[model samples]
Target: MKIGLYFGTFNPIHIGHLIIANHLAEYSDLDQVWMVVTPHNPHKQKHTLLDDYQRLHMVHLATEEYGKIKPSDIEFKLPQPNYTVNTLVHLKEKFPANEFALIMGEDNINSLHKWKNYEYIIENHDVYVYPRLKSGNIDPQFVNHSKIHWVDAPVIELSSTFIRESIKNKKNIIPMLPAKVWEYVEHNLFYRK
Candidate 1:
């Protein structure tokens, strides 16, 4: 089976994240999309992150109804400061029968070279990149890579940071996230001080 690994912290999984996963499963050759819940992303700031288990639970709540979309806690058991290369290596070893591909935004692609062992990832795994609003053209270096696949997905200007701020201010996030996930956030007071 071919799977697309959509890696993120998912402090709270939003509609945008679901939309992309659904689109990938429906339109692409991928049979499923696993939302790889990272404990800590090497490239991102640590202070803004929510507890790993809480974030993973939120992803679970958001994707519960969709069989094709699964919440993965693979990184939770891995080493600290989660790196995509290491995660991919581990996944390849464990799920040898499953063909794994990387799913991410074009904005991240611009900075891909800075990631740990990025060249190995590009050479070994296929990458499905969705466009981010205001993201400029792809870098020439990345374009030369045969494993890159660009996807046309709706650009929703929602970020976990923005959602966290809204929750902190007692603002409505119903439109931005799934109802079940929104309820989870509210009931748990996830981002509230």
Candidate 2:
């Protein structure tokens, strides 16, 4: 099986994320897309994040309806300050029969070179990139790399940060999140600081 790993904080999984993951699962050569919830991203601030399991639950609620997209807590058990290369290596060992790939946005591709052991990641796995409105220069070395696959998925401008702030400000942001996720968030009074 060919699995595409889509890593995110998923502070609260929303419609835009679903669209991109589902699109990749349905349109790309990848057999399934795993929504790998990161426990803590080195690049992101830790204080703003919801608890790891809480975020994972939101991902579960968001992706439960899609057969091709499933939630994963693979990173939860892994050592923190999580690195993509390490996860890939661990996954390859655990699922020896499957071919693992990465699903990311254009913006992530732009910063790929700065990631730890990025060269190994590029050499060993295929990267499926979805469209993003953010513009930045991609590393020249990856410009025409065969390992990277540009997927013409829809350009979604929505973001989790926006949703969080909207909720905090008492704005109705229900439409941005999956129904179950919204219900969970609302019931828990999340982000309503």
- Candidate No. with top TM-score: 2
Winning candidate number (lDDT): 2
Per-residue lDDT tens digits for candidate 2, residues 1-193, read 9999999889888899999999999999999999999886656766768998999999988888899999999998898777889899999999999999999999888788889999899999999989788858777887799999989999999999999889989998878999999999999988887
CA-RMSD of model 2: 1.7
lDDT of 1 by residue, 92-150 (tens): 99999999999999888998989999999998999999888877878898886789998
Task: Estimate the TM-score for candidate 2.
Answer: 0.95
Q: How close is every model to the real structure, measured as TM-score?
A: 0.93, 0.95
lDDT of 1 at 158: 84
Each model's lDDT comes to 0.88, 0.91
Please identify model 2 stretches exceeding 4 Å from their true place: 41-45
For residue 171, what is the lDDT in candidate 1? 91
Residues forming the 10-long window of minimal summed lDDT in candidate 1 = 40-49
